[model samples]
Target: MSITPDKAQRIAALAKLAISPDQAIRLAAQMDDILGYMDTLNSLDTSGVEPMYTPVEHVSVLRPDVMRQDISRADLLRNAPETNGESFVVPRII
Candidate 1:
């Protein structure tokens, strides 16, 4: 399919693009070249080729979930700007 100036103008308008008349003519020719290349690619036959989903093989490494150390609440609350008896306090948002 070939792209004409009128078609290019309509495409630019639909895409909310502000292009000059000269730019529209150039864009039409560029679009035609792109469609021509796509047509050439469509002519290639790949009947037995396997489709690749990812470029490389991937494996998930699993690890056991276990706690190694314990932290005191006093140590955590020491850096807070304001804190209640057991938790940090902050300004309330509605």
Candidate 2:
């Protein structure tokens, strides 16, 4: 794809980047070159190739979830300044 200086200026504006006119012209050429390479890559056939998220072989190791004893309610409410018989008692937010 060809990238004009005007297109580069608009792209810079959209990206919130500051660039000079000369820099925009230079960058537009570079951007055009990169896009041309991408276009070349896009023309390659990969019909039988599998899509990969990562280059490396990954194994997600996870710990087994086991049922365990939970802390008693009385123990949990011990440190609270204001707690009812069941739960915490805070000032009404509404």
**Top model number, lDDT:** 2
Regions of candidate 1 where Cα sits further than 4 Å from its true position: 45-94
Question: What is the alpha-carbon lDDT of model 1 when measured against the actual structure?
Answer: 0.87
Question: What does candidate 1's lDDT look like per residue over 1-94, in tens digits?
Answer: 6799889999989999978889989999999998888898677898998989787676866688977658789988889999995899989977
For 20-71, candidate 2 gives per-residue lDDT tens digits of 9999999999999999888876788989999987876767776889877698
Where model 2 places Cα greater than 4 Å from the true spot, the runs are 60-94
* Candidate 1 residue pairs in clash (backbone atoms < 3 Å): none
Which predicted model would earn the best TM-score? 2
Q: How close is candidate 1 to the true structure, as a TM-score?
A: 0.45
lDDT on C-alpha atoms for all candidate structures:
0.87, 0.91
Q: List the residue pairs that clash in candidate 2.
A: none
